[model samples]
Target: MAWVQFGHAKCGSREPTSNARACRLEPRKSMSLDRFGHSTPTCEAWTMLQSMRRHSQSFLIYVLFGMLIVVFVFMFGLPSTDSCDPQTQIIVAEAGNFEINDSDVKSGTMRTFGDTLRGGDKEFKAAQRQVLYNMVTTLLVAEKAEDAGFRVSDDELRQYIVDWEKGNPDQLRYISGGKFDKERYKNFLDYYGLPTERYEAYKRRELLARNYLTMLETSLVVSQVEVRDLFEKRMNRTDLEFIKLEPMHVEHLFEAPTAAEVNAFLAEHMDEVKAAFTANKSEYSTPAKVHLKEIIVQKNDKMLRQIGTETDKAKAPDTRFKILKKAVIDNSMAFDEAAEKYNEALVYRANGGDRGTEELENLSKQHRDALGDKKVGEIVAFETDLTYNVVRIEEKLDATETPLDKVQSDIASTLIKAERADKKMDEVANSIFERVKNGEEFAAALEAVLYAETPAEVPPVDAVDPTVVPDDANPADEPKKAEEEAPQRVKVDVAETGPFSLRGASYGSWSRLPMIGDAPELARAALTLTEASPLAPKVYTVEGSRVIAKLKKADTGTDEQFAGQKERLIQTIRQQKSAALLGDWRSVITLSHPEPSLQSYGPWVQALFDQAQESGQFKVNQAFLTPSGSEVAANE
Candidate 1:
């Protein structure tokens, strides 16, 4: 009865019955073979005997199978307790009934951040938090989409892939080798560890999310007033006048920060210092580098003809290369001597063809491959873009990091210098600014503070004598000729107050004005002022010189100009408003589902394992999650 309840069939029953004793006997339709191989018809005693024997054998077999299963359970444990069981997967976190596990977190991290996982513990933890947040948000969005009855049919998914392949020619070429092949595309996904079904499901979720966001954005509207205001801001021009201040001019105004001052500054801005250090640590870490010496020969028609046979024109370069290769291999001359003798580039020849230390990644693929794993003193030859190179690896250095102790002092010194320079410039600017506010002329104040002479003025055209009358001019015709002739030169007014001036530098415009140097900052500042708010002085540093300027003029465009731009401005405003509304909706949706607590996830799993080891509760077999050799090779 127990075996029947557990899904085993009862003896003599055509259908699997739950009750062993309820098995009904059917009419004798087939002859039964006895132990001696004789066919027999049904009789009550004989049928009863046959049923008992069949039941006995079935019972015996079931017991033996049960014993085998019991043995397996003792040896390998139940499915729920097995580490490799899908149902018993390690759950990192849970949202409702959905469990997020270690494998899922790892796969998401790899998909999003790639090899940043190999970075230091701080970087690794940050990447893990980011991946977890993204996964939780994506899951929430997908759940919402499903609740809204959004589903992607098989035909739709197939057509989406087809459209994507058609749109992305480069990707298609890479996957299908320059031809469209459905099977090849499927294989490409498989090779990258993505199955076709999984990819299609991901795309369907992405499409639904996009559609949902689009729907939200459609509700937002841009008013006419907003459009008009935006257009005015964009099209309206500004004319500016401002002073330019240079650090060198005010360097004497302040002293260099003392060591104590630098230390105090560092303490005050420790957050910024730490951020800079973290961001630029790579600059302190040296990459694996190679030093090379190369002999280069430029290929030309003459060289090709000298070494090539007449039969194949394309093979000429190869033939010439072979000759050069044989010459280098024969050791008739050293590489340096050959470079000096044959190379036309002076820098290479003078340096004995030394290329200096170079990071392998910075080199071209052909060069990197040739030198990457080669030994010192080994020679390699390669051809590139109409030139041949025979090179030798002179030295190789393993990548090393500069200790923080060594670079900390240098970083502190640089930061202190920059701060001191800014302080000195600000002090000088404020001093000149006060003088200008007190009604002293801007140019005069700048000259007095910087102890610099005023700029020389360009002479007016009227100051130069009129072009001398032609020696052969008739007296009566001279008056008419003089009237008809162009004036000797056109007289133009130049600004006399400012150190440099740009006339007609309109608001919200970049135009090169005559007579004054191009100083956009001066122009922009000048545009913000009017006659009523005159002399708004500011200092600007231009080309290592301090330019002190004050507003000279301001002008606004007419209403007609604005009217012409209204339609285009409305379109621009609508696009900006739609994007902003969409962004706001996304933010709200993301916040609606708070990120799962990742304290016990990602790299924290290692910490837990470490605690377990100390307590003799667990042992770690593998310590790190570095990519395998094949993975690294594929990436390279």
Candidate 2:
């Protein structure tokens, strides 16, 4: 037979040619011998091992394929960075060398507008146009600041943040669904594409801008005179001395009126009633009010003893514990009464342990619910820590109907006084108009008429001159009348002597000594002196009362007193000029940028204009309001 020869176990054998060869057979390299063919056993074994290796390789390949599939599912299948749809755009405005963007507008304002228009699909689009003007203005200011090379230090920014956080702990409630929630804060930042670091940076920039403006304004001088003048002009400060007429105390005038009497009064004075009502509807409208009260029974040692007694009954060893328990339960009925009568901490003791009426709003929630639908004098019970409250509904008011009746008496009284006032005013005005026209000296005529009409006497000689009186004079007897009689009246006169400066004009008019009306006329006349001018009496009449006043000893101090005000005036003048320029520029800018809107920023812009006018820092550009109602360019 033709046999394959293999050296050193190169050939596979069922029984090795040597024992060593059988132990270490080279299966991969050997050939198998069979009855039908000359094939080596090592060859078959090697083929089987190769098949097993291929299966293992296939398993690993499957695992790698699965891992790649999982990675793709986690990557593209999950939420993408761009998935949250945000319709956002940032617009910028250039102010000289620097630029500012939409983000410069306060976040609060932007969010408010957003929330207001959130329902409609086109809201965002509308908001873009509506917000553009304010955004541009804010951005321009911010950019101008940047160009000025103003920067806030990190420490300053941190301090400001701490201050803001302290002042506005409640603001966090709005930022986080009314809770101190971290996730809400994070979501808010994430939605705006801002991290904590960027948020702080923005806040610091805002603080810096505010500080810059404050520093710019405060560094300039503001005089006491300037402040006082501003206060005098803007604030309505009047020194009034009048006894209030109380109808309630003087009940004899209105004990009981027949229906016909009331009707006759109403009918005779229809115009007066209408005028009073028209001028003062507010006085006739009643305020929303509630009547509520609280009963407080505080816990103290006596109550603690009672509680201990009950506990002792429950824990009694030899005594009849069940009987003691029953007795304690029966005594519990009077626990509230005991608290009111004997408890040291009880606050209410009078009116059968009653508390007075309190406002509904002031009542606690439980108290309000307890009082629901209860009528007057209806006693209801509620529990407290140490006492049971027996509350009586003392009063209730229907919102609409109740106010009308409550204010009717006030309305009627107001109407009557107003009628008296108008008639008195007309009488006084006509008198003044006639006296001035008749060549009567205004100040002299005022004092003479005032003294003649009222029971006011000149001050006593002792009051006027303390040094002229003698301590040894008789206590009861009066001094003998002098042969020279007292002057019946005093004369007042006016003079034009003044510093005659712009600063003087700002204080209205000044006087060292001023005349007064006789006591009866004094209170009425003060209200008529709304404006100060060349010396003349200011006379006022209200409800049979008359007052007379005259300017005396005028002193308009020099502008040296307003030295500190000069710098502030200069800045205010500059701001006025800038504002004027802005107002004029707005028309042209709005026309150019028709897509955006410009709103009326009133009072704020107008205040600067008014100040400049009064301070003589502004020139009237009469051409600005032309016959054709078109604005013209102004310089100054």
Candidate 3:
């Protein structure tokens, strides 16, 4: 009897008694055989059993092949120690098939932190996450640029790096302590463990991203009507007639808030109080401060004589400052003692020349620059317009928040007093405003309600010369008689008492109006009035006083003036429109291609290691995870 296996070579051996060739068949061929030792035909049941045996044999072979592949992968292929290992090549984010990884994040962090990682691990991790997001976004932008056929040549990229370095020479100087040393800069990169090639690649990416943004910004077009409208709004001017009623004038009429009143007010406006506190907490807290001892020498004759040297010519006025500066630099005297001996300003000299703890923002620019980054006991000399100062930093204090408990009482009292005063002032002002609206003159209404007085006129000095002596008077008695006689008033054509011209006042110019008396709210209120309804609808508080203003006149410029500014106005409008368009484009791109989660790639790599450790598919090298002696020493 002979049998065949489906899709396989038939047995050729002549060993009929052996079972080795019992069901074998030749490759690419199939045959049917009888199962009851009959050569002619087979029964249906026997044929079915033969078919089932062939299929089972094929299924078993497929199962064994799959198992072999999985075993090979687990034993050798999956646990790769090479750079191409799936673990090492895990993708943090993908921008059009460009995979971001932990190495990329590490490079970015190194570039950003340089030699000084300011806030340690927390700052580094935060910066790394941000950098990863930025890198992914930039990569997407670069891809878009490439699709648009934009290409940056090697020479162009090199030139951009050069320009960037040139533009940031001050940053380099600061890092190198006022010297640009290539070796030192290289060492700094080494300290951060950033490779030169990786840094250059980052710079290239930045250049490409910036170019993409510029392309979008430059495509914006602004209309002529927009330009003209912006011009008119910015350049049109007005004249105002205003009456100012100060809170000081009416504050005496209001009583101070009693304890019960304060508590009641706070209870009524608890939400407002909390909101105000949240908004203005920084104002109550003191910022980082430094206490200084200073010596100021004015540019005067006395200062010049003390430190100046006489030659064939007269002594130079600046010589004294130079000498004093040299003396301080030479450490001939302590800063506090020097300030006491040389300081000309009496206010600072009383307490060992102490300037007290002052916020850096409060100091003059020169003083701030001299003291910035200075350590205690360090002396610095800097000059202002009229004075030469030598300052010594006595102490430095970090910023601290003021406890709410301490300030709560004062805040409550102030808020309650202000609220009561505002209500009282508003009632008085509203009554007067109603009268003005009902056809009473604004000046008369003010006078009736508040007894407001018109400004007194001053006689011109030229009209009554104090130096002149009358010819008919006795010389000795004439002086006394002239002094006793009232000076004759000069008739001057002054504008109506309240009428002040802000005709040339454009945007932001109202603050410069001398007639408004340092009240910005008054100036703003005056600007809002129109010729149709000259009177302001509401009274405003300015410098603790209530104010109401009328817009006497508004002069939109003539066509001739508009023609002169048309070109400049168009340029300004173009810039404004371009910025808006750029902003929109940036938003669209960022939204369309969102960044991956901000879980830093470093942590992701660590998580992979953790999973690998659990599965036993890979063994973690403890040495790689442990810091080297040098690294530990450096951290210490």
Ranking by TM-score: 3, 1, 2
lDDT of 3: 0.53
- Clash totals, every prediction: 18, 11, 10
Candidate 2 local lDDT, 1-636, one digit each (tens): 111222222212232353242222121122111111232222233333333444555778667655654564454342222211111312122222222223422242344353565544344433443344333333234334566886666555444443334222213422444333445545565555432332444444444445444445445455555554543332322333212222221221112334554466666766665666667665554443445433333233355333322233343222322322233244443433533443223344333344555556676677777888887756555655454344545567654433443444445555554454445444544464356446566554444433344212323334444345558764333322321233233322332222111222232233211222223333223223343432134444434433333322223324564465555555654454344334322321222222222444323333433444345432322221122334432422
Spell out the clash pairs found in candidate 3.
8-25, 8-26, 9-25, 9-26, 9-27, 10-25, 10-26, 246-545, 247-544, 247-545
Worst 10 contiguous positions by lDDT, candidate 1? 1-10
> Can you write out model 3's per-residue Cα lDDT over 1-636, one digit (the tens) per residue?
122211111112222333232221111111111111222111222333333444555778667655754664554343112222222322333342244445656655565555666775656655565555556555556656667876666555545543434232113522455444556545644554433333444445555655766676556576776666556555666566666654444554455667787678777877777777778998778788888888776766554333312111243435655666666678567655665565666677657679898887788888887787889988888888778787888899988887766666667877876776677678767877788888787767766765442212322223445566677766566545544443232221112224344432333344544445655555555556676778777776666666666676776768888899888777766655654443333322222212234222223223332443345422212222223342321100
Measured by lDDT, the strongest candidate is 3
TM-score of each: 0.41, 0.37, 0.41
- Sort by lDDT, top down from the best: 3, 1, 2
User: Residue 488 deviation, candidate 3, in Å?
Assistant: 34
> Can you write out model 1's per-residue Cα lDDT over 112-145, one digit (the tens) per residue?
5556456676555455445544444444455455
Off by over 4 Å in 3: 1-92, 101-122, 143-208, 219-226, 252-417, 437-441, 452-533, 541-545, 552-636
